[model samples]
Target: MLDATLKAQLKAYLVHVRQPVELVASLDDDAKSNDTWELLNEIAELHPDVSAVRADDDQRRPSFLIRRVGTEVGVRFAGIPLGHEFTSLVLALLQVGGHPPKLSEEVLTAIRELPGDYSFETYFSLTCQNCPDLVQALNTMSVINPRIRHISIEGGLFREEIEARQIMSVPAVYLNGEPFAQGRMDVEQILAKLDTGAEARAAEKIAAKEPFDVLVVGGGPAGAAAAIYAARKGIHTGVVTERFGGQVLDTMAIENFISVQHTEGPKLVAQLEAHVAEYGVDVMALQRAQALVPSRSPGGLHELYLASGATLKARTVILSTGARWRSLGVPGEDAYRNKGVTYCPHCDGPLFKGKRVAVIGGGNSGVEAAIDLAGIVAHVTLLEFGDQLRADAVLQRKLRSLPNVTVLLNAQTTEVEGDGNKVTGLTYKDRTTGVVHSMGLEGVFVQIGLIPNTDWLRDTVALSTCGEIEVDQHGRTSVAGIFAAGDATTTPFKQIVIAMGEGSKASLAAFDHLIRLPAAGEAVAA
Candidate 1:
């Protein structure tokens, strides 16, 4: 169960319990059930306000329900909720024990005001970094509204259910016994899906916002840094993004962040968000920018349109809309997405444990994914369309040393093979021989490089051949009163640290531009 240090930590956390909480188990006599009991027993013994009892009502063995003493505010775990889900379990206990959920007033009110029953079942893997947030959101909602119920099921522990439901990805969610969602999500995203008018309401709210001095159009490291720096300069700052973290949320290990020895993407994003919040930066999350309209006159407001038809105005705009994982456009790739084809190896690799899989591409990401998957899966076949690996020498050396990994250079993925359900294998072509081949496997991880999210700006901004926003050393774009940074720009490197530095530089440059401009509605030159 829990070690000494873990038990001590659990005890300290249990002190926040204000009401009697029960850990009702619906377990069998299996080894996993015994382990669950040990965990539950250790937790129950820590505080007087907590207790464990048997209730063999659920069909899922080794399951347990966390409920308040006198109310139906409860959540369930269908398996051992350790690893990434450990935080979800702790938060569930605190919330069910009468502690308020750590969400905004608007989100809390929305969850409590939901109209109908919502039995959310989130299928998760222990190693997935993206599953915890989604699971925790549902769990918190269940506690906030008794009509909502969330059951977090570990995909690794329940092989039958994973197969029966054809779940090939972690954090796969089901609402009221039907497919609901997949991938990383927060409370706001959940609400947007459940409430039909949530989008309209959010659009209206965003449209009512006043113009800002510096309005950043992303929420990755670059956008966060730009927003913080602008706000610190005593200028009105705002960040409008599709999501707060961007591709960073899908990332796992982040070892090269300078001062920080080691950290994960989600953890770093959380800290970045907190830092931005401290500066009182107006953050408009879950909003996608559709177009950018530059001001016709000096010091006039610049308009940024959203996909929801909501528009925001600002003095200067910083485009840091980062990049997304590039997918193999081969046939069946889209049809079997999350059904055996996945982009994130760190998040979905565990689902293919002990099974054969293929890693596409010859770049650093592809090689790294192959290396990481070698330790988890039975065998890994690395396919590269180039003649040689483009990863660093050190990475290539480590990848070559893996016994379970097979590297195939000059191989191009042609198509993904599936049985109208899950991915079965893939077809590839040999670059030199002009011969086609196929391999039977359970999963396919596409590690192709990222594509910058600058499609909407292609018509507005000066774009490079690859569609990256073209910018100078000072982060100034071709358009007046506009700047760009991060992966979306023509930056030499696509690292997080570089993006942040570029963002800060862009903010300073924007500030300089603002100070030299003429009064609003006055005639001036760029």
Candidate 2:
């Protein structure tokens, strides 16, 4: 049930309902069902267009359906969608009740014309920062087309089902009873995966696009800032990204972003997206850049190839592709990934409730993950390759204060041990004594560091030994008219504010490169 303050906020949001909405809940004698019944009643009273009733639409108990009055447009919930999913609930109510979803017209049409029947079952955690995107996206698709139905499940409340399915990650999605995806996914990304010819069609469309004056690849804070700055200069600007938010979407708490005291990653990404949209910057989402072919001449045109078989030409290019979580190449690590190995403690931590777990790394992320998981899991074993932890003194102190935490130094993770279905333990080597040991645990959280997303640009640009794009102080890369920024580049600290500043600097450097170039088909100025 919602409290007085939450009820007031829900009342304000309910005013957007232009059509009738109904809440049909399937219940039992359980406490969750009781809470669901009360929550549905409270929501129905918030607006005249909303109503609540009892029904067995689906056999799942303590679940509900938000259906439009006269149409099959709505979504189903396998458990009470609250906490991180509360936003999904609110957006579903509004979209199904005639409030339009914030999707491009092209995507909206694609969802409407989808041919096959799709029944999506998304398993999510209430604390996951990346789960809402898929939850809200599929819910909106169900509204767009009658053939598509989405049922989102809260993984914490359905432990038996999770174990049976061997699901170890948040936002694990299944399409028609088969594993579809296991990470953050937006509507466009989902459509690209579901529709077979969608990629080819998109490729052709992108190939036909006019060459941009300034083109940016990646959609993190750096890419967003670069696109905005370039667009402000009255030049043709475009940004292509596999997803708009990047790794920032996976981040849970962001309190040190300067100016603003506190904000979630999703909220910040939403604002960044909105800000980019305000400027007329052409946004090409759900596209991956496969290779970079720099133009031989300055300010001529740079060719960027996409994995979708599309090619984009730009006068200037800013590579802002961000980094991803570093993987432990140890055997069984890959096989056990999403089976018990994960990177995010905030999202998937609850799934390992009262279970023994290990955090590999000695840095801030590892210590923080250990501290956070110590509360939920039965015990925490932190294995560090170095002799001492590299985390801040404050964080190390806090991690040591936890009674359930155990720290091991000079320990090298050798292999992840699993039992075909799920992980059962780990193997590590003691560097000092050259002895091997094993620890029985249910989960492995890798927080060593980040690996830059720069494999696609390997031979095209000069890169550091660590694979980060080599860039000058002004953000100019080795290739003329080509610039780089953010985590993918040779930038230090790898913070959000630094990435934004670097992006602006790259845009300015790109603009300077552009103005000095001679007109098309003309020689250089004397």
Candidate 3:
């Protein structure tokens, strides 16, 4: 289902396979197993150096093994690779055969020093853009160290295991049968968890006399830009974030970032991080910001409390916490998410080309999604919970202009119906008549709304009715010395380019705010 351009890229990538790889499918008479077998066969046909084989034993029927021609890489894919995860399967093929390991001496040393044998079972879905990265990282680690056995389990194919583990999200990794991490994890992050010597050291509780000139919260695109700009001014800059790449890490194809024709989320995030690291910014990753409280002293230093019981004091703070899509709480919505139900049409819509799909919600986003999908998919079903669409008249008119688009008003999506492997249909009810209906489709896109990450701000700053932080034109919040940007603020049209610009603006504004303050220790000298 790849486009011409993507197919060309894949072919070029496949040409570098040094040794032949074998896909041994151990499949039963199930839909997921059959799908996996078919996809493997297709992949084998695509690459000259790859071939598929069937196993006679029932013990390993549903599972597939990918190993180099002579060497034993011990990589296992538990299900079919589809959606965004297809990239991971391709990468695994490249890395397994003749491609040198991409690791630093320090990381290699840590991997070799790992004490005992551990099996990493990572739960993932085909549509999850973030899962592939973690799976690839873990698999690479397994290749590096023989003691580590890693398997990428397709969550949709293993529902019983999912129920046993209570895996609600993709990329849920477990090391030695215990939970390791929940989201995308870079090599450094994973090694930190594995190597005891690399674990974070405890710091003694002592109130700091010195303060940072600027502190950027949230390590998303906005925070990365803010930190870069702030550090370039030669000021003491520090940034604390739960994850280095916020929502962007979960994104897949990003074709609209300006100048870049094609780039995945992790690739762009790596570049953003590299740019920020070029400066003198102290980035504290995997640190959650608990509360933002102003210092009791007269100098107006703001203290940011972290979940680890540490406080970060700064002269100015920039909020770029970002936002997440509002989810449908109905049954199978979470289970089938990233399987056949997706959130980003721009990212995952192309994967379902020539297949029927539905977009939930009646707002501008839903109509726009329907309009976008109608061109690619065989059919587009737009279901709105409201009596009428809340989209602009122009967008509504354009949506109606599409030949394959069908609009359903006052439709309440009750459940996302799906087979054990992928989405098959959706069940909804008519709000006016209370009549329930079902429609067969391959994908469901939830376009309701985005929930900002400003709830943790509490009553400290001015907030909108929907909990979005209120900020002025210069990215300055109602409270001086504190600024907000990106989806966390009242910024219209939440896009990466806009967030980067806003972050730059906020940094310059913070610098302006700092220049007006008394010189460091000048008041004390007085």
Per-residue lDDT of candidate 3, residues 331-359 (tens digit): 99988876788777765565566789999
My TM-score estimates for the predictions, one after another, are 0.98, 0.97, 0.71
lDDT of 2 by residue, 1-526 (tens): 7889888988899899999999989999899999999889989999999999998654688789999998888898878888999889999899989999887798899999999899899999999998999899899999999999899999988889998998889899998999999888888888888888988998899999999999999999999999999999999999999889798898888998999899999999999999999998989988999998988875578999998899999999999999999998999999998899999999999999999999999999999999999999999999999999999999999999999999999999999999998999999999999999999999999999999999988888999999999999999998999999999998899999999999999999999989988887887654
lDDT of 1 by residue, 275-380 (tens): 9999999999989999999998778889999999899999999999999988888899999999999988888887888999999988989999999999999999
Regarding lDDT, does 1 or 3 come out ahead?
1
Q: What does the lDDT read for residue 239 in candidate 2?
A: 98
| Runs in model 3 lying further than 4 Å from the true structure | 1-74, 77-115, 121-128, 153-183, 188-211, 252-255, 261-264, 296-300, 328-359, 364-381, 390-406, 412-445, 524-526
Count of backbone collisions within predicted model 1 = 0
Which of candidates 1 and 3 is the stronger one according to TM-score? 1
Clashing residue pairs in candidate 2 are: none
The global C-alpha lDDT for each of the candidates, from Candidate 1 onward, is 0.92, 0.92, 0.81
Ranking by TM-score: 1, 2, 3
Candidate 1 colliding pairs = none
What TM-score would candidate 1 get against the native? 0.98
